[model samples]
Target: MAQLSADADAFGPMLTIEQAAERAAEHITAVAGSETVPLAAADGRVLAADIVAPVDLPPFANSAVDGYAVRFADLAAAGETRLLLSGRVAAGADAADVTTENRAVRVFTGAPMPAGADTVFMQEDVGLDAGAVILPAGLKRGANARPAGEDLPRGDTALAAGRRLRPQDLALLAALGLTKVAVRRRVRVAIFSTGDELNEPGTALPPAGIYDANRSLLRALVTHAGAEVVDLGILKDERESLVRRLREAAADCDLILTSGGVSTGEEDHVKAAVERAGELAFWRVAIKPGRPVAMGLVAGTPFIGLPGNPVAVFVTFAFVARTVIALLSGTQPVRLPGLPVRLGFAYKKKAGRREYVRVSLAPGPDGIAVARKHPRDGAGVLTSLTETDGLVELSDELTSVAEGTIAPFLAYEMLTG
Candidate 1:
């Protein structure tokens, strides 16, 4: 655990999204240990070391199509050239047994190319004349023939360290004959929600009580970010109980996460409870839906407090908590790439604060994507997330956007693992 900036004034009262992200990255570092797991279970786990290829991909030259393997020199410059059938090679068969002089060998896809064969003519492109095959002169050299090491050469890096393995990465490792891989251990996070008004989902709600959606939302978001969750359930506004839980969670968890009770409301007790346990900093990030995000250390464990609104919780988790988890899990952080889309509706926002507007996309008259704003703009509207394709990001410098404006859009798929 490294010492974070204790002076809140050093970061100022308000920070940009980029500045907050940089501060978190500077303070919290990857502390996860490494473990070797079988390839089948390695998906979504970050690599601990680079994976070097042990052998050349497609170790031997092979045919790319079911065709006749022939030497380029044996074909005529124009018209067609007929060659006697030498031998046949199917997938998994040896090509050394074929005779290649002034003759063509029948080859199938993935079959090793016959010795000295430089080209392949698809069976449909040539005619067979009584135990011989006719090859067209126009066929280029090495056509339909796959060379050895075409995909990756031996000793080359197959995957880099810090890469979160996907299904396709698993295929590449499997092709290199790897059964297991070394990856960073999953990050352990203790999560909970605050406010006595928050009730369990299964229990009946009191007059002023609503079911706690943030806890379930946080759990899913944390798990999707590749961190294990220790659910602490909901904590009331009592400072003593909150302090006790925070200390206990920080003792074993790598990160502590909570929703609500971080704002400046009189009833909010999480801020004081965190101070009793450890250090806490209230960051007024220039972002809509979520602004009063609290971050600090609880008994040496990093802690993050997201907003109470469901939409705010989703937005903040995607941008803030997601980055923190990536760092703690030893995974390389990747910025979510946004796609350019034409705005179908006009929008206005305050300057110096980044805002994410929920939008659904549809093809316009010209077949280009047109982003339409969600009907409701409330921070607590969960349907704004479920019914939309993604968010239209409004930068801090931009105050207004007119219809037909080209905006950077981030799809929901890009935000999740």
Candidate 2:
């Protein structure tokens, strides 16, 4: 992988998608800083330290249902047993001390069990007559009770470091009465789009100009990968402007991303600007719809250059850019989630490069998930992404796929999260 960028003419061929990802992971490193933030602000952030349970979950033994708390010894002794009604305990109320023989205490769900009670019976199962209660038969000991630390005990590791915080994690932290948590700092990313024919949205289009869609698409994807985006807007296909932005972004950002102007053409400035400002590590990957991807460093800040096509930007970002961003954010490299799905449509291809086809899922004859390729397979077809559910990844060695072949499927929801 290193030799692929060092020698120009000696380079044999483009690298595969897996090879590109491995090289990118080796080149990228995590930021070293961390901060303490409120739990509300910790969503999507990676944990910098292990989270230990400060106290036992549910801290005390409690009742799991609305029932009568009693001494199992009293119920186990004889044919028929009756107990005197002592008192009622609701959730958050103090537990009553039961000492006298054949006495029971009324307990509601989540209420602390009485000091001398060892069992519980549903209120409907026992008959309450006047001042005494007739306990039901066939009641088991230690039933309908939640013991202390049933979920998590004190001093135990609740969550390990490098784990991405999600909504359910916030709930768990809140349950432990944690107000703030230590987390790795968000990776700051500087992003821009290049091309003379690209214009901002809501503006009048020139003779051959089209609105820039790659910037918005990449910005959203970067932010979704747990990085804060610094939008540099659109730039012309000029080396001077591109170099200036690269230098400025390197000063404050951890990484830089540019769409378009990566290929070898007179209008392409990203490749030249990166070479002048710093170093372009490698370019050109052996993958369909996104063969001209570029990666490098600008003043020590990681840089990734994606193709100008909207769908190309999408596919390459899912496989390459997102993994780099994860590593840069003090976390582990996460591979795209893949599942096996039967193909409902037959497809043929040459066995040289990897390809990803937009597809939707349908129920096969055997009631299994089937991948149905979208009608449009063009790299510039943005509508195809919206119409499909995910992507079907084809390997470089497999030439054709039969209608019932089981292939790898990557869902759109997994790509962003």
Candidate 3:
């Protein structure tokens, strides 16, 4: 991995969420969206290019159900027209011999319609005899016969580029007899936690110290968002160690993520390291619990340093880090899908920044009401995040929101696991 520049301040400004998003988008453009695989292997992957149907689906007129293929015109004068059974047609049968007029061909589901047959009448509507079957009333021409290219036309673009492969798309492609596909390559990402006091899970928690949770959270988050996560583990609060791990991460990973050690303090080696390797833009966001976010680059690798506080970690991960990841992955990322509800109590915030407040939506006289902050205020309180159902988004301009005020609450269920 390339060593981050020892001179950290040269990368650029500490970007806001919006600025980081733009840079991330630019970074994503550098990646080549080219990869090909089987249709069965393209699930959840973005299409590298448009997929044209190589052949018409079904490729020929076929039977839609178990019935007899017949010519509707031959039944004009009779209550039931008895016709000799020419042959039985089953799926995958290659027999293409044309059936003579007034002859009914026994056809099963998925069987290609014999040439010259214009209609199919259900078996239940036919009286089966030793050598022939009698077609009953209500039989119509062109009924239950699937026409050539009816499902899809030859050379038609069935799927467009930049679309994520879905289950139905896979099935459709499989039906077209396509064995492979082209897709956008996966985004490579690396994550590390910085703190001497932080310990990995399974280690004893000494007094005044805690196990590292942010890394686990981030790894889960990155994987869920469709990026591969390289675990860099926890780095002790040492500048030299931070630089080494960061450089290694930057060298191999397109995105390097770390939680903690970016704030303005002597121990904040992450900010210093990021500046030494790339650039750090500190964003003074209006959002509660996640105001301190660092967006920078390390050795040309985009470095996203989040807050050490657990609640802050969750907020920044969803709103800020997620957007960066999405942009890096060549997808347009937006805020969580929100559900409109009324605030149960009064709340206030300073203008010019967005706020995300942990809230528990309650049942009220009208409907679901948002109320009560999580018990803890420290950014380190992970329990506060788990206990809340969602976060109510408060715009910066609103100095105070009175009770019963309607607000947009982004449900935690929608944003987090």
Candidate 4:
């Protein structure tokens, strides 16, 4: 791991969320290398190159329904027209042997259209008279017929580079006859928490010790962001131990992430430990619940320190670490857009800092969804997250919001996804 240059001091003491995000994007310029993988294993991996179609989708004109294929010009304009039954075409069968001039060909769905037949009457929409097929009038030409390349044309780019492949993307690649694709390697994240009062779960608690929750929270979040997590457990609030762990993690991980010990408290050794090992910058972001966040490099690996509070850990990670992960993983960093919903409760906040209020939704009399704020505002309230549907994001300039006002709401699914 080589340290990337991040002049964090240039931004001053406090940074807006947008400024911090931009700084991360500018400083973290390196991406993981790519590898070729089979299509079955490509899901959730970011694409390293564009996928171009070698052949047109469908490859040929085909019937969209089980019906009678006919020449539109041979049908009478105002009444039903009967045509001699000449041939039949089933799916996967060639249409070269069928002669279809003024005659009808029985075609099943996905069957290649017979030469000179430009229209199809669905089997349910026609009748049979003796050995002839009768089609109703007013059916337009090319009805129920799929033209070649209608979906994707040959030589066109089907999937672009930097896109995270989904299950549907695999189906498209398979349709393009691709057995393997080039994808960026998964990012390796080294995660740990620092605090003397923290204890592992499933163990008897000491007098005033609390269970460690941030590591498990971060592991799931890092994995969901398409990275591999190297859990380092909890580091005690000691300068030497913190420095040692930081150095060790930097040797093998792409990013070193930790929770707590980055604030101004005396036990906050992460900032000093990082400075001792490499470089660090404390970014006091103008956001509620997560103001004391830190970013830097440890022995050349990128480092981010989240706040101690569980809610703060989640918020900071969603906005800050998520971007770093995207950059390191070679994927496009897309900010999930907030959905607009009406506020059911009034709220007040300062003008300079952004706020994320936990809220639950209910349908109002006007048919619009209403967002009600949670009763607790403490950062340490873990139930505030589990009990709310999402967060109502109040912008930095917003001073107050009245009942019935429309506000931007970010659902948990959107944040985690």
Candidate 5:
């Protein structure tokens, strides 16, 4: 599991969102070294080693069309170069008879080019007689012929280790006749939420109770990140059960995440249970909606204690969770593409802490751009984040920005799957 050692210092004071994120990335323990998994099951899985080309791609010079392969020098004349067609070669057919001097060969797409042939002329561009295929005038000297080793040479590293396998990667491996490949095992993450007052959706709320959306939302984010999410179900405010469930989940999960009982004053038992079972490190973030996000470990499993507030939970998952997972997987964490756009409205930042202002995007004079400030309030509000295009990254260094000042926008699309 990926939890930090007790040697890591706990959060001391109020931390800026960036500082909290950096701390989580540094302190969380990794889920051990990577191990190889089958290629059939490796899609979206992180790679464990570099894939070197076992053989030269295409293996040999091949035809890229169904036509005639001919010598370039032999086709210098304006009229057709009536060279004898030594033999026909379709894909999968090995050349039985090589094209002799100044001769041509009838070749199909993907077929290995014959000796003495420098180019291919499409069949439609050439005329065929009893035993010879006539080439058209001006047929280029080297047309439609893919040279051997043009794509890759043997012993070359075609794909770097730690590279995520995309569809194209799979296709390339298939072309190389590889049935299976080694990939990093998927990190298993366990997720849930806490609060005796919380109920799953579809259940009638008994007054003060709220819907348990954190577990589902967090589960989706973890799975979409190429992890195996073990749903531990929702836990109540009891410390013993919380500790028991955490111990159970830690047996097989690399990380454990919950959405409540993190703040120092919370009577809820998640924080207490973490301290009892393993470690509890809290970071009081300085951001608006995500300030209460927490981090720690439970029974050796890296623990992510997001605030019960929906918006805060999602925001913290994006900034902090992604960083920790990327570090564990040895994958480079992807920073959201922050595009500079003029704020349609004015916004003030908390003097010493960076803030994320949700904003809707619109087409500006140049191209796609974003507007400023939506509901800058409670973490429970999800509508603003959903309605807006992204978050406006208001740096702590800047106390305020005018209506027309350009500010960097981080799209919500970049945060979630």
Candidate 6:
């Protein structure tokens, strides 16, 4: 593993959230590789190139309903007009030619529109008597008939590059008569957790030892971000062991993620290991509950160190690590999706650091959805994440928020969806 030159000391103050995100974006780049896969396996993958439609969607003009196809000129305005029935056309069958002006053909839904027939009157709106159909008054031309290329045209872009394919996107490709597509390869991530007082579940606990929740949270988050995870488990607070694990991860994976040992504690070893192995790009971000977040490179592989607190780990990953993962997967980074929702309670904090409060939706006085803050504010409380619907973000310049004020809210799905 080779080390990059160190220039992180030149940056003086703790960086804002936006500044930290921009720095991470500048350092990371998309992997330059792609593979062709069948449509069945392309869901959740990023597209490598634009997909153009091979042919029109419908291929030909068709009937959109079960109706009688007739020439609009033969219908009268004040009274019903009679037309001789020529033939019937069902879906997936050939259309009948109605050459006579006063003739019509019985057509089912999705059936092809007959030749020389300008419009269709729904069967329920007309009458049939003695092998002849009576079209009602006020017949409109081209009614209930779907024209060719109405949904999609040939030679047009169907899906753009850098788009993460969803279930609906796969259906569109199938409709375009495509079985396979080119997609970026999945990103490989290596993750681990560090602390002396942390213990895995299903084990007897020592005095003052707590079970490790950060590892499980981090793993779930990485998987939800559409990346392949290489979980390295929990490492004890030892300098040499941390260095060895990081080196191995850098050699075998595209990026490294670790929780704990990056803060300014005397027992912290991960930060020093990062500085010795490579360059610690930045360690402190101006955000509450996750101010100890760190980003660096270990032997050219990007590394992000999240705080040990479960709430902090969740918040920092949603706002920061998610972008890095997207970049590594050959997709463009997305902004934190947020919308304005009314506040149901008052909140107060300092102006320099940003904060995210766990909140659930409640009914406001004006019948609009309002955000109600959770009672617990500790970073180590994992229930704050599980019980709340999402987070309410407060910017750096703002200090206090009164009841009924509008604030930005981020849903959990917006982070992973």
Q: What overall lDDT goes with each candidate model?
A: 0.89, 0.86, 0.76, 0.89, 0.77, 0.85
Q: In candidate 2, what are the lDDT values of residues 1-417, reduced to their tens digit?
A: 111143323333587888777776666778878999999999999999999999998798899999888888888565657888988889999885545357888899999988878788888888888988888678778898887888889899998999989999999999988999999999998999999999999999999999999988988899899999999999998899889989999998888888899998888889999989988777888887798888878777888899999999999898878888888887876675589899888988878788898999987778779898899889889999999999998999989988988888999988888
Q: How much is 332 displaced in model 3, in angstroms?
A: 4.0
- How well does candidate 1 match the true structure, expressed as C-alpha RMSD? 1.4
Which digits, one per residue and each the tens of the lDDT, describe model 4 over residues 73-137?
89998898999999899999999979899999999999999999999999999999998998899
TM-score of each: 0.97, 0.89, 0.74, 0.94, 0.81, 0.91
Q: Per-residue error at 7 for model 2, in Å? A: 8.0
Record all residue pairs in model 2 with backbone atoms less than 3 Å apart, i.e. clashing.
none
Q: lDDT per residue, candidate 6, 343-378, as tens digits? A: 988989888889999999977777667998889989
- RMSD of every candidate to native, in Å, equals 1.4, 3.3, 5.3, 1.9, 4.0, 2.7
Judged by lDDT relative to the true structure, which candidate is superior, 3 or 4?
A: 4
Model 1 scores a C-alpha lDDT of: 0.89
TM-score of 3: 0.74
Q: Mark the 10 consecutive residues where model 4 has the least summed lDDT.
A: 1-10
Q: Any idea how many clashes model 5 has?
A: 0
Alpha-carbon runs more than 4 Å astray in model 5: 1-29, 32-40, 64-69, 72-100, 103-109, 119-144, 266-269, 286-288, 339-342, 372-378, 404-407
Candidate 3's residue-wise lDDT over 1-417, tens digit each?
Answer: 212333324434433456545555644443455678877667767677888999998799888989899887777575668899898899888548857487999998888888788798888878888999988877667999999899999999999876657699999998999899888787788888888888878978898888998988888888777677888888888887787888888788878888998778888888888767666544344456776677766767777888888778888888778777666666567555577888776777776667787878777676666576666656777777778888888876788888888888887656643
lDDT of 5 by residue, 1-417 (tens): 554546435566677766766776776644456766555767767777788888888899999988888888887578767777787898988775775467778789999888778789988888778777777787666789998878888888887876767678888877776777877667787888898888889989998988898888888888767777888877888888888998888787787778888876667577778788887676566766676666677766777788888888878888877777766665656776688888888877668776777788787887747485675556787787677888888787788888888888877767764
The count of backbone overlaps in candidate 3 is: 15
lDDT at position 313, candidate 5: 83
Q: Arrange candidates by lDDT, descending.
A: 4, 1, 2, 6, 5, 3
Model 6 clashing residue pairs (backbone)? none
lDDT of 2 at 222: 90
